[model samples]
Target: MRPIVVTTMLSLDGVMDSPGGGEHPRAGWTFKEVPFEEAAYEIKGREQEEAGSMLLGRVSHDEFAPVWPTMPEFEQYNAMPKYVVSSTLEGSEWNNTHVLRSLDDVAALKDSDEPGSIIVHGSATLAQGLATAGLVDRYHLLVFPLLLGTGKRLFSTDTPTGGITGLSVLESETYANGVQKLVLDVVR
Candidate 1:
């Protein structure tokens, strides 16, 4: 089965809102800081290598489809297979991408004969849904030191809960700029 992995940017308070403290949410919270350039590069590279395909929600797909295609650093990702989970999106303008209309399809994808994992990034709602549905196999939360205290939250709803556990601590490291990346394996 292609492992289902989630990679997200979160705040110290466990809030997955805008890391960018300004008007742009989750903007400045990334490794865009001058000191975090090398660290960010390494992390992104690792993530790319670890995943065989990307599963994006509507929001993240909209945001990523426009920008990632233009950035050379993320060119590999743009070329990578992307499965967008969206009910409204009838078609995709991006290359190497397909839209999935139902959450039920997740299980079949997980069982795909893919070489690598199916990774989810910046899809808080979808991530939460996958976790609640007991579909996720692993989670990578990159915690930054700062907090906006409000914005996009990781857990969007409270109704579907109590599906995740058996988290084996995989790796944790503190960066120079206080961003700590924690990788966890969700034991099934």
Candidate 2:
């Protein structure tokens, strides 16, 4: 079975709401605090290159489908297989997109004979669910320096602390922009 990895940009307070300028109250907080650098793009590109498929929740799928397709930088990502977990979504118009009706479907994907990592990006709800289910294998977190006092956090209150124990830090890097990248493996 392939690894199920979750990559997210979060604030110092663990808020993962809007890392890239959105409708959130603390919109653009990430960029406002840390200047964009080549290392950041390099890190993101490396993740995209290593991923065989992307697993997203409805909210993330809707947010990305409209924008990523139009951008030239996301050409490779758009070509990869995308599985969107949603009970309400009937279909997807985006190329290479599939709908997953339940968490069982996600489990099936992980168990599939896929070649590379199944990366989950910007899906806080789905990430929480995966954490609760003890399905997350690794986490790649870009932690920004600022703190957004009120927003949807990466680790919600419902998440049991026991679920995240025994994590082994694989890598820890501090970028030029003050954003810290922490790669952690969940030791089961």
Error of 2 at 1 (Å): 0.4
Q: Which lDDT tens digits does candidate 2 get at residues 24-60?
A: 8878887776788667556678888899999999999
Model 2 quality (TM-score): 0.95
Per-residue lDDT of 60-104 in model 1, one digit per residue for the tens? 888778778888887768888999999999878888999888778
Q: Give me the overall lDDT of model 1.
A: 0.78
- Angstrom error of the Cα, residue 26, model 1: value is 6.7
Estimate the overall C-alpha local distance difference test score of candidate 2.
0.87
Quote the lDDT for 40 in model 2: 59
Candidate 1 clashing pairs, residues 3+ apart or interchain: 18-25, 18-26, 19-26, 19-29, 20-28, 20-29
Candidate 2, position 183, lDDT: 90
Model 2 regions lying over 4 Å from their true place = none
Per-model C-alpha lDDT, please? 0.78, 0.87
